[model samples]
Target: MSPQARRDQLIALGLAMVGERPLEQVSIDAIAEEAGVSRALLFHYFDSKQDFHVAIARAQAEAMLECTAPEESLGDPLRILTASMSAFVDFVTDNRSAYMALIRGAASADPAMREVFDHTRSVMAGRVLDHAPALEIEPTPVVEMTVHGWIAFVEQTTISWLTDPLITRDELLAVISSALPALASAVGAVLPTAP
Candidate 1:
């Protein structure tokens, strides 16, 4: 395989293994074996096991961002947001294991891992802010903070749903969708009113 392909293969294997279990429980040996490569080969692609885990974490974060990104073709902001929310629900439902591993596993605590998590949250918040004009709201600090909090709520709700799935996916999506207007209203309540 080409060098890039080889590297991608290792990362793919790592992600699969990590998805199966928590990062602390996943073995580097198993990852290498699954990739049909020697442990040394895996090490060659990544300086250390930590680097391998970090790479997988980064990939997972990027995948989540891609899944939630709004389509530019959608002219209506509400339609765009709805589409993004639907994509987010589908991605979490399909990648439950990987999503759990990334969000609640050891990666949650590692500085490198936290960097990716923080970046993803910031990106999501920025996307919401980008739609402020369409939402008829100013992108004030309160709105920004509300968006961040809403993202956290989404993450927790996803984790809970993945664990038990007590509600239907459509219901879960409705619950999430219903929160946007309330969050915007909450932000509005906090903003100073004109004299």
Candidate 2:
């Protein structure tokens, strides 16, 4: 495999393992083993475990952006918002383990990784506006914080749902959908007349 291919393989393997276990419990040797590469090669690719963690976080961010990128301008605000939520839930459900490990590790250990989390939050907020251009709200630090908080809340909720299989998808969607009004209100955006 080419160098880039090997790197991709390493990242893919890392994501797979995160689903299997928590990040703290995951080992470099194990990652190397799963990637079918030498520990030394893994080290060569990433200077340290921390560096590798950052790389994985970056890859995840890119993957998420690709997944949620609007194919066309979803002209309707509510439709766009609901579509985004659906995509988000699907992403979390499909990559539950990886998202858990990434969130846990980024929140605790990696500054760079945390930045990726922040960027994702901004994108989430931007998605809101993209779907509803007439929100009549100005971009401000407060808006950013609100968006960030909403993203974090959704992620945490999704994490809990992933851990507890009892939460049905519709139930999760209903709970999340019900909260959109509050989220929009907090961010100073106008909510639609009805659900």
Candidate 3:
């Protein structure tokens, strides 16, 4: 296989293994064997096992962002927000293991891994701020802080839902959607009166 192809293959294997457990729990030998390559060859692609796991974590983070991004074609802010939240819920449900590993795994405790995770959170917050205009909310400090707080709530709620799932997915989505107006109120943003 070509060098790039081989590298990608190894990374793919790493991601798969990570999906099964936390990055720290996955064995390098298992990943190498799963990829049908020698352990040394896997090391050749990554400077160390930590690097390999970091790559996987980064990939997972990127996937989450892509999955949760709002569809630009939706013109209404509320509709766009709802669609994005639905997509986010679907992504979390579909990739439960990966979601946990990336968001709450041992790797998240590492500085490098945590950086990737933090960036994802920042991006999510940025999206909310970006949509502020459409939502008729001014992006003031209070609004920004509220957005950050809401993102944390979303993360924790998602983790709980993934772990227990007592609530239906639609119910979880509704809970998230219902929070926006309150968040706007907390930020003192006067939303247009709902019809």
Candidate 4:
């Protein structure tokens, strides 16, 4: 295979492994073995294990963003927000270990890992900003701030919900889906009935 193909293959393998186990527990040796390449060959593409970790984290970040993109077909602002929020919850549910690993990096001392987490958060918040005008929500600094905080709130609530799952999935999703519009309302936007 070509170099780029080889790199993509390696990252794909890393993503698969991360879904099953935390990044720290995943070994470069095991990934090399899975790829049928020697450890040194793996290092040829990545400077170190940390570099490999960052690459896999970035790929997963991209996947999360892609999967959570609001459906343009929905058109209605509340519907779009509801669909995207459902996707976000489902994505995290589908990759619990991987999300935990990202959270670990987000809270760790390493700048690279935290960047990946923060970048994901920022992009997610930007998506809300993009859809704000449709809901008649003025995109002011206060609105932006609330949207960002809402993302963090959703993330934390999801994390906790996964651990205990005290409420039904529908109830949890209802609360999450309603959170942003309610927050925007506090910031002076009149949202239609939340989904």
Candidate 5:
């Protein structure tokens, strides 16, 4: 493989392993063997195992962002929010172990992993802020803080839902979809009806 292809191959191998186990437990030796390369060759692509895991975490972050992005083609803000939340829940459910690892890794002391985590949260929060006007959510400082808080709330709630999914998927979706709009209502903005 070319140099970039080799690097991407190693990262893909690591990301697959991440889906099965926690990030810290993703064995570099196992990945190298799976890639048909030496551990030293793997190291050529990454400074260390943590660095490789960081790359995996970055990929995971990007995947979540891509999957959870609102379908602006849906037009109505409420409908867009519902589609985004549904997509987010489905992505997490499909990648449960890996998503948990990403959450745990973000909570770790690793700065690089934390940066990836923070950026993901920022983009997710930004989406809500970007659609604030349509949602009738005032994009004030307090609204910005509320949006970030709601993102954090959804993350923790989804993690809990993964642990014990007593609630039906649609119920979970309803709660997440309606939450920010309710918060906007609390702040004097009228919540738009979902189409």
Candidate 6:
């Protein structure tokens, strides 16, 4: 297999095993055995466990992007946001383990893992900018900060929902919907008056 393809396979294998375990419990050996490759080969593909984690981060970001795709082009901004949140909740529910690992590891001390964590949020920020242009006020840094905060909120809430399935998708959707006005207000507050 090509290097990229092999890397994807290893990432998928890692994601599969991570399905609900904490980040610390997961090991390179487990991922290597799961991928049917030796530890050396795994290391060859990725410089370290942290590097392999960057692969997983990109994969998770890709998955999130996929989930957002369907609702991204909707005519109504509110509907688009609602659909995205519902999709987000569903993805987290379906990939609880992987989601947990991705979130936790990205927040950890490893620099490589942290980069993925930051990059993944940045990818999501671009999407938010597209969806909520009002947030573009106050220059790029402010916009990015606001977008990152929104991403963090989404990630935190989704994880909370996963901890208790009793929180139905509709309930989460309602909460997300309720936030739209506040998000709009904040975005609008920062934006300058149109000429």
TM-score of each: 0.90, 0.81, 0.89, 0.93, 0.94, 0.80
In the range 1-195, model 2's lDDT, one tens digit per residue, is 998998888988877777677656667899988777799999988898877877777777778777867646776556566667788889877877677666765566567778877677677778655544455544455655666666777788888887775779888876775675576675564433322
Any runs in candidate 4 off by more than 4 Å, and if so which? Answer: 189-195
| Residue pairs whose backbone atoms clash in candidate 3 | none
Model 5 stretches with alpha carbons more than 4 Å out = 189-195
In model 4, the Cα lDDT at residue 182 comes to 82
Query: What are the lDDT scores of the predictions, listed in order?
Result: 0.80, 0.72, 0.81, 0.89, 0.86, 0.72
The digit string of per-residue lDDT tens for model 5 on 117-155 reads 888988998999999988655687778888888998898
lDDT of 6 by residue, 96-153 (tens): 8777777886658877777767777777667666766543343345555666777787
TM-score of 2: 0.81
Please estimate how well model 4 matches the true structure, expressed as its whole-model Cα lDDT: 0.89
For candidate 1, give the lDDT of residue 163. 79
lDDT of 5 at 108: 80
- Tens-digit lDDT track for model 1 on 95-144? 77777766763346578777767787789889988998887888877778
For candidate 4, the TM-score is 0.93
When 1 and 6 are scored with lDDT, the better candidate is 1
